[model samples]
Target: MLAAAAQDADREFSFNEQEFRYIADLVKTKTGIVLADHKKNMVYSRLARRLRALRLESFEAYCSFLESGDSEDEMGMFINAITTNLTRFFREPHHFDHLAEKMSEQFGNAPTASRIRIWSAGCSSGEEPYSVAMTMAESLTRLSAYNFRILATDLDTSMVANATAGRYRLRDAEGLSKARLAKWTIQDRSRNEMTIKQGLRDLITFKQLNLLHDWPMKGKFDAIFCRNVMIYFDGPTKDRLLNRFHSCLAPGGWLYIGHSETILEQRDQLIPMGKTIYRKALR
Candidate 1:
């Protein structure tokens, strides 16, 4: 009897047609994130607050508000509410390890270029880009000789603003080593707050960018770190974004992705270098 009741409850919890269609449209129009039927509750939980904040009574009315087209600011708030930004410094260590090795190879024999350009796509709250900067600083002693720049971008404007500040809680810098913490981060003696050092801070530039939109990057990059960002995107979207990354990379340049992600198609364009790492196939 209990098992039957539980089954009935689960069936009743399913998302209705209106909600499903609304979420589907949102996924289609803004981001390539597809919300399956099973994700109905997740949609409600994430967006219910928007309705409450706007003093709307129903999801349908909220959808109408979003569609009214006068509420672009609210639309941005909706995107921010729905998007997940779970990330950390060196969240996946292997990518950084591979990146360090690649940088050495690129700069080993030849005189370092005027700048080593790197992009940290979906660099949530700046941890990943700052991690890249710290890694480069640690690896290269003659930092003045080599101009190193990291472009960190994310779709969330709030996140971009936070990344620009370069301030984080002590807990956020947990996994970072003491030496790195000392060299790259500064702690406020009075408040126990932590901020990225000016030197490391200057090495990175943070901007809000929607990957689905036209890329504004000018120069080609030697290495692009776009890890853990494609899990939300469908296969075709992933392919399109990867192709864009390919276009942005220099000849024989490297690309690193989250360990779980892989190039579903276009294998010819990017040669598999190692686990979750690919190098652009030199034409």
Candidate 2:
């Protein structure tokens, strides 16, 4: 027992198994994110800042504050702290390549087709949807003929705000080609930032959204980019989300997921089009 006591004494906060389990359960219940045993350190480190900010002494106190009915604002802070947002411009190039190639075939054949909708479900910051905008702008000959829009949403409100602002550091946009950079963004040398051009910004709507909750969109999407978001969820959550995506997609619409993600059970509903790309089976 002395060894265990010494180990506990080394910690900045008094974190025990019970408190960890409680936090894990709450996260899973509210956000569908499963915190495994290996994540204990990560959780402790991330939440320690909250303890300092709230002036809470221990993990037990933090857990109690969360359980209390008055933690609505704190809960939002907690979720923001827990959710990871690591993304860059065109992180996965192949997805955009496929989108560029398929745009003509999908919409070009139907000259009367006037609406093209794309949803970036876990759009971190703004890169993914901006990439989509670039592809759409370049692909279509008669751009003004169709009503094309991209919906970008994220669970973290801060991320949503950042995306809505449509501003980023120059280094963050280095991956983009010279042509895309020149055409789609305005350089602000004073601030060392680049603001997305009004044309690209006009095509996108960024909003805060929790994927576990009900989605407010009524219209079907022609393409959905929910990349890297499902890594946090368990098997059941992933399965449910895949089914939901299938339902949300327009007939023969496309779904682009993270490179690491796979569709094991939803094969019948979504067919593989290319690497990490799936198409909603036409009814």
Candidate 3:
């Protein structure tokens, strides 16, 4: 009976290989994210529920609906359903430590140049950029005297919108200290939620961006925080993206990446600093 039940379950939801390939190709063309052959089950598992929720019959039908492009909202829902958003405040604290120290050193030398611009590439739900803002606010109490901006961008429009709202559950600040939390966030009396303080929110500008496409910024940034975003990309794509980042960063600017990724082969453009961070080679 158990064997028969297992067979029945397998037969109920098995995805056809052709359907998988079709979905994979469409996703890659739209987002530059490659779903490997082994991810067939993952794609089906994530999107299958969406299909049911939308009252669609099968994966093929859902594919046709997505291809038709009649409903932008449904397409967005499809993308959001498949995209993984795993992030937290103060993730990889060591990187922030490095950023704070570097900022102090830079400020000491060029005290007159008050403006500091940073871009948080692939900023998932704003935690990363908010973390940067909190660090700067704490370390630079005289920040008003200096111009500072954190441009946070993500490919996911929903994530960008959520980040722009600057609201989060209390649990999201678990890694933060009581002092930093008090300084950077305020609890909403009515909603029973915490919002990043207006000061911190003012320092950040969240936007939807696809790194594979042209950047919209007018000038280069002082530093860019692009952590844990390239693991999903192919090697050539990663290299090309890094090159673009190098071009967009000011001379001797910093690039922070995920700890697991290394650019040892691309050392000419990106000088290896300690940890996974690199500095764009000065021109």
Candidate 4:
């Protein structure tokens, strides 16, 4: 049974407190993710798979290798494996509703004024950005009237590549409405997979980016969706990213964070408008 398997899995790896702490420090140093004591089991479970894949026998050995210079190449795989990517189409629907409202306001006033730029930060597996694309595609009747671009970035390269592919299992469509699916996706029953067609996929650019590092983008965005991404970071990291996001926004731009996450500093820059939504003020 699953219980017995879990018991065996617990015994398979030797993760001491010191080893775990070392890993916590390394992950914190490299990725800005604060892994605490409560996450010990989760860490063991996730990294255990990595150990098996790498043909390593124990956590002690794995940790030793990780700290050594030999792990430079595998550091990427380590982060990718440990990083959580749980997401769904139209997740936290209110953000999408607010997004539609903003788009409506933009087109109603001046549809051809400027390029509408939206950034989906920490866009795991492309669902969030694709959802944005689909929402804009459906809402904007005069789609070609103005320039539009969405920049979707995540620290995980695998995630960015998958998002760029715009392909998913057909069963994944369960969360979306029938009409929405019909409009934005091309279903292949034989392959049991669905892919985002060219029209929808063309609106966005998927890139690998680390929020903690310098961003190559030199332009401002109208709206930035950084939902559920900052929960893992420490206060100073979150504060710095928020400040960067504030600087990256155009006047009257919007910033959205995860419902569970909150801004620890800099309340003066963003005025919260709705659930987990804040509008940027001109500075």
Number of the top TM-score candidate: 2
Clashes of 1: 0
lDDT against the true structure, per candidate, is: 0.81, 0.90, 0.83, 0.87
Write the number of the candidate with greater lDDT, choosing between 3 and 4: 4
Candidate 3 lDDT over 1-283, as tens digits, reads 5864564367535467778888888777666778898787678778888887888777778877887858578877877777778889999998899888888777644565477999999998999999999887766767767877899999888899999999998878777898887877897657768988887899899998888988889888888998888877778888888889998899989999987777866798889888888898778
Instruction: Give the Å shift of residue 262 in candidate 4.
Output: 1.6
Residues forming the 10-long window of minimal summed lDDT in candidate 3 = 4-13
Candidate 2 at residue 32, lDDT? Answer: 94
What RMSD does each model have against the real structure?
A: 3.3, 1.9, 2.8, 3.0
Cα lDDT tens digits, model 2, 1-283, are 6975786789899888899899999999988999999898889899999999999999999999999999999999898888889898878999888898888787876665489999999998989899888888888877667888899999889899899899999989867998888888999889999999987899899998889899999999999999999989999999999999998999999999998888989999999988999999889
Q: List the residue pairs that clash in candidate 4.
A: none
TM-score of each candidate?
Answer: 0.90, 0.94, 0.91, 0.93
For model 1, the superposed segments whose C-alpha errors exceed 4 Å read: 1-15, 189-192
Q: Which whole-number lDDT from 0 to 100 does residue 118 have in model 4?
A: 94
What 10-residue stretch in candidate 1 is worst by lDDT?
Answer: 7-16
Which regions in candidate 4 have their CA more than 4 angstroms from the true location? 1-10, 109-113
Q: Per lDDT, what order, best first?
A: 2, 4, 3, 1
lDDT of 1 by residue, 67-129 (tens): 897878998888877777888887788877777777776675557555788999988888999
Candidate with more favorable, higher lDDT: 1 or 4: 4
